[model samples]
Target chain A: MLKATIDAEIFREAIEAISALVPECRLHTAEDGITTRAVDTANVAMIAFTLKKEAFDTFKATKSEIGVDISKMKNIFNMGGKGDLISLELADNAQKMAVSVHGYHYSITLLDTNTIRKDPNSPTINLPGKVVISGEDLNNAIKAAAVISDKIAMGINPKDQTFYMVAEGDTDHIQREFGKDELKSLSPVEARSLFSLDYLRDMGKVMSKATEVEVCLGIDHPVRFSFDIAGGNGHVEYLLAPRIEAD
Target chain B: MLKATIDAEIFREAIEAISALVPECRLHTAEDGITTRAVDTANVAMIAFTLKKEAFDTFKATKSEIGVDISKMKNIFNMGGKGDLISLELADNAQKMAVSVHGYHYSITLLDTNTIRKDPNSPTINLPGKVVISGEDLNNAIKAAAVISDKIAMGINPKDQTFYMVAEGDTDHIQREFGKDELKSLSPVEARSLFSLDYLRDMGKVMSKATEVEVCLGIDHPVRFSFDIAGGNGHVEYLLAPRIEAD
Candidate 1:
């Protein structure tokens, strides 16, 4: 078993930034240490990794150690990177587990040690409205609206065959329009949703790594996206809460 | 004059990533409301940016409309994407300049626009050491050292005829060694220097954009590097201060 603690900001900065540039990462664990697996097919590619036992001492003060799923740990550790070394410990029977990064430790006591559910069932979401569009275009549209407003209000009117992302502030207001079929597949049921620009921007981290994303929309409902990732093994789903309209 | 208030992050993220990817942007001032420029060719590419006066309300807000050097603005806008919409204003006399990004508006009073140096000055240090290696290797080395320490200390001794990069923390330390005459030239004069890992990492940004780089090392002095960038006018010179260490 292996356990370690590291600078949370350093971990996030490296994982988030680099993961955005590549696909899924394979984490390797052994009796002596832990290793990360990533390949750069691109000519300009490189990966630097290192981990020590002392680094994990902060988190695993008394507990001996545990192996970790770098992928899940990466997401769980995204809370602004300010914590002592993350700690990991495996149960004596080696059938269950616990992991923590930057003081945000979570106990997954129910997980089966031998089976890592690659496609765990993500929360089932039935969005009232939907659309299909280029990730690039959608990313750009979000960026444009985000310039002036902290949150973007997206509305799709199937009858009108239009999709809109709007943001308004006291001194600035922006409305970006993308044709119904410009880059997305849209359903007629009209729906509107609002989400923080910050979260959406963070979402951009995964856009390029994954080719296509499906966005589910509803009035004041949380936005859900299903990523058709390159790898056939893992199932990752993201859900974001929407900001309620004052009116 | 073009002025607009864009989201600090949206603008910064796109510009920073793109600039790091491309070298020497060709900024064309639209004579009749159209301008185009091409940067880096293969990995990362950017095309014409079309913003009509209607789209650019700030253009409608001012009378001074002139094309300015984008490269300069790109350099000064180094605080990262937090600098929201950048303000491009032509001086009343058309010589000075002003830039507002990320809430910080800087007024750059130029001594002489024509005399101001646009090119990075090449230092004449008669560098005692030279190395030709994979940009990836160097980037990785710096990254590893950066993890433990703020600055990387490098030692070059003729007696040992070796090059070393070391990072030492209170309890953590790392060392990377390169063979003598790693590249093209190696002189007898022994020298050692320490420089900020952050700045070196910034220079490393060009690594992915270029294949091979020539590194020049001086004793207790600034380090210089030149990259044979691909695509457009690809060249950059980065100078960094040496960290003093008392033995």
Candidate 2:
């Protein structure tokens, strides 16, 4: 059983982050808050998301795993206006959840968890190099590189103490290097990995609103992005696998 | 010879109005300003547009006809930042037109006049019923109707002194009626005609910015939408052929 009232904007922000990586998820609800860990079908990306109870205006829940259709949540919120108070209620052992926002009532049938893959375990990896930068700057670099190639390489240049993102096209390449002056903070360590722009582009939009995002990198390994949302009451992490660079 | 400088925004508004109907246009430039009239490939709709000299920051020109690729202009302008003054130059009988906005210089090859359709003659028809309403309201009605069906009927009822727009779908219909309180002014003349919503939706976007739009209608005849752009220095008219309303 679960009942909660949350600001529509904050709810939208949370749902958008989950929807970016998967169409559906197994949401774990507890007295403290809700959390979800899921990987893309192709196993190219993974998202670990949490919305703490403090982020909601009122919250109550028992330990339970709820199957949520992320796309359906998007459609439901689209009908709501800004600043609306969204109320969500689920009875014990019920297959349907009741949602009300701005005079509209919607009964959404929960997805069958048996059909969705079990929640993935967050992998443990060592990434020594790290940099914190404004989300806008990170998204801008991703957009600029996408204009030249479908793959982007991000790394920390130890010698210059800079973070750089570069994309190589068949005949041309674009690069953006963030020096100490532009970065919020940086650990001058060696790191470089190539990633597909398709996944980064989707994740970039969600991160663009964050004030600061910590990007962790490793040599020839997956990259991780960590950021806070809902005024720091909620948190999100994105882990993207590196692509093989063909010579 | 022709050389002129205009605000990027005003120029975009005028081109967008024309491009909604045709992709290419034979632009006629004179000392007074520029004018273009073209019909869509299917000839189901027509656009009559004019941009006076007063709308430009600097203007000078001799009588000439220039072929303009509307879609190409869209691409060029996409590179220019807002508030940038666009400079257009064409030497006497030159095949290339120089367009400079911001720090970029683009030389566009003019399409062959012979390859484009000749100027379409404007048909003279009497449309007695008229209503003047805010462009926002007009566009809103068009959008609301589009959700119901592909065809919309616009009319002025003599008995109620009201303007009505209605659309009928397979099993549902939506109707919006503007009384004296809602419309700026309405002519109490019996007029009704059905038009394809595809054309209206494109035209609606351009009209949404105008302060006021004048709508003229006739019995089983075409509907005419007239509005001003560039702060009254320019004008645009869209005449869409009526579609048969099947039972």
Best by TM-score: 2
Question: Which tens-of-lDDT digit does each residue in B1-247 have in candidate 1?
Answer: 4344434443333344335434444322342232333333441222223333433325423433333344455677666464246665543455555667656777754344243223223335577676656676677677666655688876666777666677764434556666654534455457678887766676665564556666667788766555543221223444455768753
Worst 10 residues of 2 chain A by lDDT: A167-176
lDDT of 2 by residue, B48-108 (tens): 9999999999999999998888986764464445798989899999987877665334566
TM-score of each candidate?
0.40, 0.55
Off by over 4 Å in 1: A1-14, A17-124, A171-173, A205-211, A228-236, B1-148, B151-162, B169-174, B180-247
Residue-level lDDT tens digits of model 1 in A199-245: 67766555545556666788887776555332322223446667767
lDDT of each: 0.53, 0.90
Q: Write out the backbone clash pairs for model 2.
A: none
Task: Tell me the interface RMSD of model 1, in angstroms.
Answer: 13.9
**TM-scores of chain B, in order:** 0.52, 0.98
Which whole-number lDDT from 0 to 100 does residue A13 have in model 2? 92
For model 2, the superposed segments whose C-alpha errors exceed 4 Å read B1-247
- Clashes in predicted model 2: 0
Query: Per-residue CA lDDT of candidate 2, range A135-169, in tens?
Result: 98898777766655799999999999999887776
